[model samples]
Target: MPATVIVNARWINEARQTAGGLRLENGRIATWVNDRMGWNGEQLAGMPKGPRLESDR
Candidate 1:
């Protein structure tokens, strides 16, 4: 289980542009964007069990 989830990250590094969600479990990255997509109002009914943090944009 993740303690926090960050969605729609537009992080840019020297290598490439990174985007998408990141799930942190136990102070570490447990899940990446490739594993799960951003959450939406439609998915609220059956949301995953965890605390998620998302941006307005």
Candidate 2:
């Protein structure tokens, strides 16, 4: 899976969770930076490399 970064993300549900950025590694969430308005955002690193697509399929 490709490393991902989502900004100003919100969740609409019973928990009503929110995050400044959600990170994913190996197709699963690796970390979540909680909601903070006016935030400059965050950096996620040290992600494990995923299987190369050319061989994965």
Candidate 3:
């Protein structure tokens, strides 16, 4: 599966602007609403997997 990087932002879609649920996929970013427009999910399966970050304090 490709890696998805979701960021916080409000975006415009189809002449209407909306907020919430914004995200970026396959190195390309867009609001959640526009994700289905042209998303091909490329480079997703090659993403590196690793353990969760730990506290070093």
Candidate 4:
């Protein structure tokens, strides 16, 4: 089974937005956003696969 890791990772989504939440996978960070606004399961599911970066910068 794939281990779902909840990391304080930073990312920018395709729409060019930012958000934060429990990261669930390890791959290429296709897109991401800030965590100011929360996300739902469906939204999280739509998030592009991305690799966890050591830092936001």
Q: In model 4, where do residues sit more than 4 Å from their true spots?
A: 1-37, 49-57
Q: Write the per-residue lDDT of candidate 1 for residues 4-49, one digit (tens) a residue.
A: 2232222221111122222332223323432343543234224333
How many angstroms is residue 8 displaced in model 3 relative to the true structure, after the best TM-score fit?
Answer: 18
Best-fitting candidate, scored by TM-score: 4
Report the C-alpha lDDT of model 3 over 2-50, residue by residue, as the tens digit: 2321111111221122121223332444433345433233321222232
Where does candidate 2 have its weakest 10-residue lDDT segment? 6-15
Residue 51, model 3: lDDT of 19
Error of 4 at 43 (Å): 0.4
For model 3, what is the alpha-carbon lDDT of residue 13?
Answer: 27
In candidate 3, stretches whose alpha carbon ends up further than 4 angstroms from where it belongs are 1-40, 50-57
Predicted structure 1: lDDT: 0.29
Which rank order by TM-score, best down to worst?
4, 1, 2, 3
Q: What C-alpha lDDT do the candidate models reach, one value each?
A: 0.29, 0.24, 0.26, 0.37
Which residue runs does candidate 1 get wrong by more than 4 Å? 1-39, 55-57
* Residue lDDT tens for model 4, 1-57: 133332334224322222233333322232232242244434655666553333233
Best by lDDT: 4
Q: After superposition, how far is residue 48 of candidate 3 from its true place, in Å?
A: 2.7
Worst 10 residues of 3 by lDDT: 6-15
